[model samples]
Target: MKRKSSKVLWIDAPDIKARIEHLVEKASIDWVHTERIACVRSGNSSARAYARIWGLNQVWQQVLDVPSYYCIEVLSEKFDHLPEHHKDEILLHELAHIPRTFSGALTPHTRRGKGSFHDKLKQMIAAYARSFR
Candidate 1:
């Protein structure tokens, strides 16, 4: 029997879910067992895409006591039409923000000489190379 699909608001499409799942699997980040990934539509016109880390805030730690979630917000107008390669790149970039700890905390990006973009690019290249061998 086929499995039922999870409900995803805003960007509720099969292709979007598949892309997210593929990126999450490839990311290999150690999110807590209960962590969830959601793709939402971005309301900001200037935003192309961004990953929002949830459950890491003080309220969650002090009250909810639950694992964090990663909400990947894609610009409804832009992301839905991007090429597959571009989507992959964007997803990979977001995944890179996640630390290996998977403890619901984020690895803050550095803006100094070797910035987040540079670091993410390096990691992406390495992962790409490993896929071939």
Candidate 2:
């Protein structure tokens, strides 16, 4: 008998931008415009968390410097492993960071220096990630 290889569902840029619009509208923020979205292969040297943020920064600068660009860069390996529902959750969580970035209120994921909001944000993100699985 032959074994079947698992195929991961990928989220495209327009879908991501649409989701961002939904989240932003729900959050009562002004509209965000995106210029483009593209995926580039990542090297092993970078941390996944940091790389994700770096991808967001790339969008931020490319679209507009001042406006926060909602983006995600899943590890190619992990991207291949993620199920569809989990992808939705992650996209939403990453979009949640946009308002903070745009407003200049963004902070590191660390818990010690910040208050409950940041921690709560992380918790909610984790919850979202878990809820789909």
Candidate 1 CA-lDDT value: 0.57
lDDT tens digits, residues 5-39, model 2?
Answer: 55434445454456545444444444233343232
* Per-residue alpha-carbon lDDT of candidate 1 for residues 18-122, written as tens digits (9 for 90 to 100): 776755555443352323666666543443334343335546756777656655566666666777777777767666666556555666667566457557656
TM-score of each model, in listed order: 0.64, 0.43
The TM-score leader among the candidates is: 1
What shift in Å separates residue 96 of candidate 1 from its native position after superposition?
0.9
* lDDT for residue 60 in candidate 2, whole number 0-100: 49
Give Cα distance to truth, residue 85, candidate 1, Å: 0.7
* Pairs with steric clashes in candidate 1: none
- lDDT (CA) for every model shown? 0.57, 0.46
Candidate 1: residue 8 lDDT (0-100): 39
